[model samples]
Target chain A: MKRTFPLIIAAVAGYVMVVAYFMPALQQVREDAEEWFNILAAIAMILGGASILGMHLRKVSDRRAGWGFSVVTLLGFLVTLYVGLFKVGVPPMPEYPDRAWTGEYIAQGSALWWSFEYIIYPITATMFALLAFYVASAAFRAFRAKNLEAMLLLGTAFVILLGRSYAGTLLTGWYAEEYPNLTLPGLTDMIMGVFNTAGQRAVMIGIALGIAATSLKILLGIDRSYLGSRNG
Target chain B: MKTETIILNSFLGLGVIALALWMIAWGQEGKFLGAQYVEVRDTIEVYDSRELAWFRTPDPDDPEETIGYWVERAALPDSEPPELADPEAGDVVVEPADLDRFTPARTWEIQRGVSRDRADEDGVVLSLSRTIGLWFAAICTLFVFSFLYRDNPFYKFAEALVVGVSAAYSMVVAYWTMVIPNLIGKLLPDLVQAAFVPEHDQPFYAPHIGVLILSILLLWRLSPVGGWVARWPLAFIIGTTAGFRLIAHLESDFAIQIQATILPLVVRDDGGFNFWMSVRHLVIMLGVMAGLTYFFFSIEHKGFVGKTARVGIWVLMITFGAGFAYTVMGRITLLTNRIEYLFDDWLWLIS
Candidate 1:
């Protein structure tokens, strides 16, 4: 019964969502279901937080390798959670000066806002920036004109890289007035708009068909993998 | 560490110290990196009443000719009065005193002359917290970038902090933006409106009770006992998402793409027989068809199919190359921005 109940719930929910597209009256049902899903998702985040805390706590308690890092993680998590949940340094709304909880959780000058601006933004941006060097090094090592396909790929990449930068304009500015289509930027635009779009569309269509078929299988109970192991 | 590594580290440290010293000297010469905020007192003119007197005028819809009558509000006392003209005869005379006879056309609260008076230098000082925040950000950025050289304690510390903080940040954001506003606000409208959202007037949705119950069940997953019950909510989520995506993808990706691919082989314009446009359309149609043919694995790839599929492979390669180039460009732009932040905002080395 443990697995059967969840399977029934899945089938019913899936069928209802599919059928709602045809019947306008069932639109409210679909919206309500979506709302329920959102609430569950939010609750799932809390579960995720708990899981992280539990895992870190276990590692710290066990005195595992890099336990100091785990301590740092716990401190960061708890401090951020405390400040955000309690709305520390967050002023009350202008209309509700007497109500402290009425203020925005991430209002300017709040501790949470400070953490986000100073810590989160810089770290994430720098992490992404570091990828630039890696991508360049990877391209240098991987790109080779061994075959017709490789040559085409390499040539297209070269054109795109140049066209996106100021150097392309400097190189092809003279030809732009006479033979615009032969210029780097013009070729780049053509490649992106025509060939790239065609390839993307074909891939997307295949993915759509695959998704539809899988969804149908789930709805009909032909696929019950989402319910997890039968032993449960 | 190797002797070479120690030497390199020493040189890097000395370079950073030198840059800092130069920045300090530059700041002493009247250029600084911190933000300066100003205080200003605003002067506003509030109207006594929302009611405004209006008059009938010729419609200004067409520039060359007046077609119909249009009702306009009375001009402010300081502004020029609008000229009332007859639509057909082109002229109508109305006395200034007669303007008051027109009925009030609109009710709107208007505030005018909202000017600001800037305060003195005392109000233009830098924020200590903001300066400190900038320094912290700069340090964190350096720490993250340190991973490029080699994994170190500083990078690990920054990584851990980011992971923990971001996870909690998302949770906090979701709680305030989604759960509290949508679920709690709906379930207990009066209480939420009184304490939180002053404008919230959502009627209690009975279905939200189900949502609350499901949320509780989902949260039960964190507990040691009866964690298996969370499967119900998880299954619902998976099922609903699958169903929604199925229709959405089919309509937007499959049907629409196929529809768009049905292009005219011959194109014409106002000048007639646009050759370039015709070639572009032909290429798009043939490209899409060939690309789709490559994905069709049911038929053996030989003869005509093989040639078309080969063309498809070339198209796909170009697509991937272009995509990679765009991604690299984006990442390089981000790197450039970070460098600018360091040199301009942190060190004050650049304008």
Candidate 2:
């Protein structure tokens, strides 16, 4: 009953949504259905939060490697939650000064806001910055010119690397005024604008067709793997 | 044990960091390598936040009236360092007769499209706390970068804390923004009051009891016995997204793209044949057709089909290489930003 019930809901919702896209009368149904999904998604946050908390708690209980980091994670989570939920250090909105708890949760000097600015902002920036080092490492080790295909890729990469930056202009810009076609930037633009778009479009078309087929399979209950098994 | 590989790696890593620090110092002096950057010293005016409140202007012909959202209440931010003021800006005289023709959404689209950085903020003095914030931010940045040397506790702690804080923050945002405003606000406006939405703006429609039931069923996954109930909402979400996206993908990815491929290969100017442009067009057409043919699995890739497939592979390779190079350049910019922040904002070494 549990399994069949969901399958019926899926097939109905799928057909309705598709119909609504073209049928004006069913547009309101589409709007209401989307709202339901949004509400469901918001509620699903609890499930995500539970998973994070559970994992960290288990790590602490087991005294796992870097258990201390798990403690930090839990502490950070609780601190953010407490400060935000209680509106700690946040001032009441200018118009609603008399209200007890109604205020901007991220008011300038608020603890939550400050934590976000100093800690989260910096960490996110730095984590992404780490990519620079990784790219360099990959270039040194993994990027090898072993064959015709590899050589062509390496040559294109070199041209793009030079062309996008100021150095390319310095090298090619002087001569580019006469023979613009042969210039680094010109070649780079052609490669990206024409060659890249063709490949990208081809891939996108294939992906779109694959998605259509998969969605159909799921709609028909032929793809029961998502429900854990064929029986489920 | 200390080995040659370890020593070499240590030297290389530390050398790169040292070079970065030097670049920052040099950048402070407005010189990198031999190149000198000119800094402009000028005054910049900050606009009042009230300007975006309504589509108002100082002209008798365009007197402001309190008309619904046609007169916007949402205030734009005060132009900061990043959001510079437009040097070319002047008091504009608007005609309400002209504005009345546009829908409020059209007016909004036109207004929002105006670039923020069109404004120039050259001479505004930096705040003390802003400078201090940059210094602290740099330290955190360095801590993360230290993972390049070797993994340690600082990087792990920072990573975990960022994850925890972001997850918690996102949860709060979702509850207040989505659940409260859309779902709870409509269902129990009397109970939630104006917390979910402004009292005046609350929906007049009947509470969607069906959605509420579905939402509760969605959360039933937390209950071990009622886990199956969650699948109903999951299936609905999946199916709806699929059904909706199919048409969207067909319109955008398939039909439109296919339409785009049907183009004239020959290029003609006002009088003569444009040989170069025609060649470019021909190459583009061939590339697209070849690439698409490569992905066509019905036919065996032999003879002429194989050669076309080979060309397609080369085209794909060029695409991937360009993509990789673009990413490398992007990563360089991020690193450059931190370095610039260190020199310009934190250190105050640059004017």
Candidate 3:
């Protein structure tokens, strides 16, 4: 009964939302669904933060190695939290400055803002920047010209890499103007525009199809891995 | 159930209804009511064009006022334009035509009274065929799914081909859509303008050229010669990105999120208590505390702190479950959306 009821609700709501697409009268169903999604996502964001915090806290409590790092993370987290909560350093909102709590938390000079500009921005950017090094190392490993096909892939990779840069233009700039039609930049354009676009479109099509089939299976109760092993 | 839970939920439910109503009303009005929109400065071309390098304006249907620049190609001169500008100052000219070019022209729209243009009848007719073609393609989808039955050569071949084709396509998109037009189109023109137009003789293309060199260095490091060439470029990218992110994190995480937490209990205009919002914040704040506490490795999990930290575990689990469920549902919705597009819009499946 538990499983059946939930499935029924899913089917009904799912079908309704689907039907709502064409039926102007049923548009509200789509809107309601979208609203629900937003609320749910917002809630999930909170949940994500909670989970991240929880994981680190447990590490610290367990006196795990790198617990010190966790402490730093927690301290930063709390300090940022405090600054934001009180809207520290925020000037009074022009309309409500006389009111004690009326200032914006993220006002330019606010402590929250200052911390964000000084602390959080650099750390995350630094982390993301790490991807470049990773990508470079990964490319070295992956882009080996072991065979004909690999060579072709390597050649394409080289073209794309150079094509994105001024070096490409400098090397192939002659073709851009002299042959204009046959320039390296032009070659890059063709490779990217025609060949690359076609390839991406095909994959996207496959991914879309796979997603469709997978969803149908789930909806029909064919696939239940997501819902855990039990029916209920 | 406690009446408090009911009352709180009711208040939250009302807010949801109100927000939904507002969005619908906004959409009906053809207005972007509460969404953030950013506009870039100019158009992009296959090759470089200095005059047309900036990102265009916010989409016409944006709900919120854009928070960006008002600089013009004219203001900056064809020779020199600011790399980035505010999102608000200028009218953002949206280029829907660019998006339209990617798809086969929609003749079905013409048939359905959604559009009346007859200029691309051939494209539309082709689009119609493609719609029906999707159903045929669905057959291949089954073959792809055959892996579930047993791992076979056929599935493997199909999967590899899909990956190969997708990789090829993505490489192209990254270059054409994101790279060539963005880098060359913007820089080339500026370079030309700077060289010829004496007043605007700014060194525009040199850095890009330098970056290009570094990118090559990056690639060359793979070769046996000057194996160290890769590190210089890597260092630049890493350093810049790290610096940019460091500044951004403070604003986004510390400032914005914190600001978001401190809210007015009562919304003045509606005279309604923002109970759900407050509860949401409080729960989030608690969750953050608990989660962070749980991660504190310096302490032992033997006492009151240990038990309190466990609350973080429960919060994390429930959150993950909900997120997974929502993601699954969203994927389903996207699939359903695409299916409906095929059945109804592409092929006249029913009537």
Candidate 4:
């Protein structure tokens, strides 16, 4: 009963979404279902938060390796959660001066906003920036002219990289007026527009078919891995 | 530690201290360490009366149809009220006392101009909190960059903080933006309207009650008991996602792509033959077919099919190379921005 009930729910929900596209009347029902799903998803985040807290708490309690880092994680989580949920140091909207809770959780000058601007933005941006070095190093090691395919890849990358930079313009800009297509930037555009589009379209079509088949399997109850182990 | 390592660490520490001193000195000299802004002249409009009324207006799309929405109009004694298209529908006069319960009185208008008045403040000042935020951001940025050298304590600390802070931040944003406004506001409108959104007049939606129940069931996963019940909502989510993605992908990726690829092999511009455009169209058509042929696993690649598939692979390689270059360029731009932030915002070494 435990597994069957969920399977029935999945079938109904999936069919509703599929059928709603053709029937205009069922569009509102589909939208309502989507909204309900979003609400449930948001609530599910609390489950995730609880799991993280439990794991970290266990790590700290057991005095495991890198427990100090877990402590730092807990502190960061608790402080942010408290400041944001409580709307700490956040002023009410100018229109709703009497209502304290009327203020935006991430309002300017608020603790939550401060945490996000200072901690989250910087760390996220720097993390992405660090990838530049790794990618460059990886390219240097991997890019070789030993074979035809490798040589083609390397040549294409070189053209694209040079075309995007000012140095490519400095070198090819003179010939652009006389022979536009032969220039690096012009060649880059052509390759991207023709070759890239063709490859991407083919890949997208394959993915779409895969998705359709998988969805059908799930709807038909052929795929029940999402329901987890039968023993559970 | 090696002597070289000790010397490098010493230099880094000294550099940090020196930068900190410079920042303090710069701040003391009235130089801000964050974003600069410009002031502009704003035009303000003053209205005499606060009395307002709700007037029924004709739907713009269909003149015969009238919408239920009542457009708010300030009942200015001097100016003439907008004439309603529907003469039968009289104006619903809202009392002055009830104006607060409805939309607030629109008394003033502010017109923003594009040009800035740079003569004011010279655009070099930041708020106290913003200034502190700059320093904090700089410190975090350094900590994250430290990972490039080696996996150190500083990098681990920053990584842990990000995981914790980002998760909690998203949850808080989702709660305020989605759950409270959509669910609570629709289910218990009175309480939400009274405490949070005073202008929230949306009628109670019965389906929101079901959403609330489902949300509670989903949260049940947190508890030790009845964890299996959470599968119901999870299943619903998965089903809806699959259903939505299937239709979306088929419509956009499969059908639309096929439709777009069906272009005329021959091209003409201004009633004359265009060579380049014709070549481009032919290449696109042939390339797409070749790429598809490469993906086809039903027949073994041999002879002409093998040759076409080889061309397809070359096209794919070029595509991947371009994509890689684009990504690397983007990441390099981000790295440049971080360096700019350090030099321009923190150290004040550049303008």
The best candidate by lDDT is: 4
Candidates' RMSD to native: 11.3, 11.6, 33.3, 7.1
Task: State the lDDT of candidate 1 residue by residue for A68-184, as single tens digits.
Answer: 999999999999999998888776554443344777788766789989988999899999999999999998998889998898888888899998788888999788999887788
The sequence of per-residue lDDT tens digits that candidate 1 reaches over residues B1-351 is 999889978988998899778868866866445443323232111122233322344445654643322222343443344556656555644422332444423222111111112113443434456668888888889999989988999999999999899989989988888888899999899988878776688989877888788788888777788888988888888888877887888899999999998888788889699888788888888887788788889999899999999898887788788888888998999999999988777775676
Q: Which candidate is the best by TM-score?
A: 4
Compute the TM-score of each model's chain A versus the native chain A and list the values.
0.95, 0.90, 0.84, 0.96
Q: Candidate 1, after superposition: displacement of residue A209 in Å?
A: 1.6
Q: Write the per-residue lDDT of candidate 2 for residues B39-138, one digit (tens) a residue.
A: 2232112122233223322233433321211122232333221212222342332222233333332110001111112223443322333334445566
For every candidate, what share of the true interface contacts is present?
Answer: 0.71, 0.59, 0.00, 0.70
lDDT by residue (tens digit), candidate 3, A36-66: 3332223233334445467768999999976
Ranked candidates, highest TM-score first: 4, 1, 2, 3
- Prediction 3 global C-alpha lDDT: 0.44
Writing each residue's lDDT as its tens digit, candidate 3 over B1-351 gives 999769857976996697577657756966323222222222212212222222434433563533222232344534454434235544444222232323221111112112213323443222332323333344334334344446555454444333322332233323333333334434575643332221233344443454455445545634656544444443333323222233344445445545544545434346766764455445555654555556565798768889767765544443433333334334444445444533443232422
Model 2, which residues run further than 4 Å from truth? Answer: A100-109, A229-232, B1-136, B190-193, B347-351
How well does each candidate superpose onto the true structure, as a TM-score? 0.84, 0.76, 0.38, 0.85
Best by DockQ: 4
Q: Summarize candidate 2's per-residue lDDT along A1-232 as a digit string, tens digits.
A: 6778778888888888888989999889988877877777788887888888999999999999998999888888888878877777655433322232455567554667767877787788767767988998898797789987787778889999998887788889988979886799888888887788887777777777888888788788887655666433
Worst 10 residues of 2 chain B by lDDT: B106-115
